[model samples]
Target: MTTPAQTPRSQDLDRIESELIAFLEGRTRASWDEDVDLFATGGLSSMFAMELVVHLEQTYGVSIRGGDLKLDNFRTVRTMADLVRKLTADKDTDG
Candidate 1:
């Protein structure tokens, strides 16, 4: 649950997406396309995937639980940002 102060807005989500995209670019083999499949693009690896989950949890203040840890949820910077937004919204709802 989050207070109003903890809730993320549209600009904040955009900022998070931008930061995440840059983070992936630093770790990947090549530049990224927003819709590119991260796994296929070498943007993420199984060994390092959990690090992303941790980063999302710490950065967005949301928990990634059983059903939320799917590969599809992390397919791109857009998707990852969407996931964080969704999870954060869920927290707002639960609040």
Candidate 2:
């Protein structure tokens, strides 16, 4: 099942969201939506964001660095998906 408005970017975000939810659920032993704030609920920490950065890099093949290291980017699954999309787009343009 798909929507008529599902662009490639949307599809990518969907995949990212599903994978992120699975990973977070496995780590926290709980389930959440893409918009849920993982940190606000006390289920995650700034330290855990590093592990997330590594996971994003390894899973998406995108190198996160500099300004992109901000904790806000990893606060929610939606934000993380957006970050991956941005990094992936940057990679596409750079190479």
lDDT of 2 at 7: 92
* lDDT leader: 2
What is candidate 1's lDDT per residue for 66-90, written digit by digit as tens?
A: 9999999988888888888889889
For residues 12-75, could you state the per-residue lDDT of candidate 2 as single tens digits?
A: 9999999999998999898888888888988688777789899999999999999998878888
Model 1 misplaced stretches (Cα beyond 4 Å): 1-10
Please report, as a residue range, the 10-residue window in candidate 1 with the lowest summed lDDT.
3-12
Per TM-score, the best of the predicted structures is: 2
Clashing pairs in 1: none
